[model samples]
Target: MKNHQNPRRTFLKNAALSGALATLTSGVSLASSPSKRAVRRDFNLNYAPHFGMFKNHAGDDFVDQINFMAEQGFPALEDNGLMKRSLDDQKRIGAALEKNGMTMGVFVIDPGFNWKVALTTGKEEYKEAFVKECEKAVEVAKIVNAKWMTVVPGYFERNLPLDQQTAHIIDAYRMGAEVFEPHGLTMVMEPLSDNPHLYLRHSNQAYMICKAVDSPAVKILYDIYHMQRNEGNLIANMELCWEEIAYIQIGDNPGRKEPGTGEINYQNVFKWIDEKGFKGISGMEHGNASPGKEGEQALINAYHKADSFK
Candidate 1:
């Protein structure tokens, strides 16, 4: 008998191996079988999720996460720390967002670092620092193609009256607005959660400051999570300050996690936003209550569930 095997047998063995390899390479397994139900949902506006929120599922790379967010149908993405990123990183991020058709939301520029005092202090040194930071923020905004940036006026100066502090914040913002206006950028001021020490802790306070600033380049950030913590009437306060609000941030209170993780009824809130015809990005500046890829999927699902309301 010849040592060579039968041609048909050899062909059969090779065909079976190829089939197995195809299934393995295509990620088809019993666990990966398609389910009858849809696993994801969609939202109407630009619902922005922050960087690193989906790292485990989307890999450590920022561009990879951006791509994943786009694939998963998130209309926008926000990086609060965009200014901290390198110029190259910012350009790359901007390019990725453009490619994925994702909108870039606010990036942190000042973040409440004694800005109220600096602007209000009447001290030239502090004012200069504030202005310098504003100038840098303008450049960063251009790099990332960001239209808005987050600003906080910091805590109130005890020696100063509330009105004085407010006036100072307005002055600081006016100067800051000048820097951004030239570049078509807006500074979205966020009122801190009521700490008793912070100056602008209430939506009304932020609203007043925005009015005082009196410029389109200056507006409120309207973070729902912090506002819900400081003041319970989410919709009413939002309505009261609606004109000044340029941007919005979302995170459930108590846990500061995705929408369904806390007591606030996000479904109703989202409905109200939709009804009001607010056409801006809602930054998801919260953390995942759970861990790993499961946590990421949960966050996605939570948004879907909350946004399911008309």
Candidate 2:
């Protein structure tokens, strides 16, 4: 299932590692070295790193972090908290990403997502509030050149029946879609696994809602870490709802850190998705395996190892 997506990138990586005087171990380490400056070796897939993921290497400034990601050859960037940043900061991030030729991944559309009385309650006030959020997200998306925003159905209204709650979710999302469709934007529904009390907890349920909503602007965010926690059969479940997925997020379970720090074999998952022809970004929505600059290098090395799937 290996994908030769970029031959020049392959050539660059191979050349950088093929120096005749190099030892086997140094060649491997040099690919993602911890030096202040490392040679750019583009990842096979568009794996994105978020802010603070590489702060020790890039300093605390956000734009500087973007520069460091570009230097390390990240193909995209995702910031869940982008909507809350000031207008100047957003424009600077947008310009930095554009300068680096990186794609903007999903941002949480409604940062104030209520966990108490979610959309499942069939409350007009809640739906109306979400529509306003959608309007606001549209403006935010424009600032970052983002096409997708993350959405979630809040907690289940335990008093109501299941079917009624499901209907309410579809109706509300349909309204959100109406606002985004004209602007060529999509709302990617995220199914989280923080706790059992949350309503949108499964891929099939999110898939059903997206299908029911029946809009191009409505789709699934598909966070692998949460999906693995909520349902263990990752590949099978992904296949069942592949078409409805618009964006993908990456995080290994148990530690919610880099790939090899947990049980999930991300190499296999990356290979499968590449084989499936997914050209979108995979948000690195996890923390470094360790602390500080050394940990940052470990994160880079882990992705290099996982992306080496064949």
List the lowest-lDDT window of 10 residues for candidate 2: 19-28
Question: How well is each residue in 1-310 modelled by candidate 1, as lDDT tens digits?
Answer: 5323657435533543343233222211123334211222267656888888999988988889988887787767788788888888899898776665566888887633554455545566666777888898888866756677887777668787777777777787888877865555678888888576677788888887776665667888999999888888999999998877778899898989999999999999999988887767789989999999999999988988998886
The TM-scores, one per candidate, come to: 0.84, 0.86
- In candidate 1 the C-alpha lDDT for residue 31 amounts to 36
- Model 1 misses residue 113 by how many Å? 5.8
Name the runs in model 1 displaced over 4 angstroms.
Answer: 1-41, 111-117
* Candidate 2 lDDT over residue span 93-135, tens digit each: 9877766656687888673656589689888888988999899
Residue 201's lDDT within candidate 2 is: 93
The alpha-carbon deviation from the true structure for residue 232 of candidate 1, after best TM-score superposition, in angstroms, is 1.2
Residue pairs with colliding backbones in model 1 are none
Task: Output the lDDT of residue 78, model 1.
Answer: 89
For each candidate, the alpha-carbon lDDT, in order, equals 0.76, 0.82
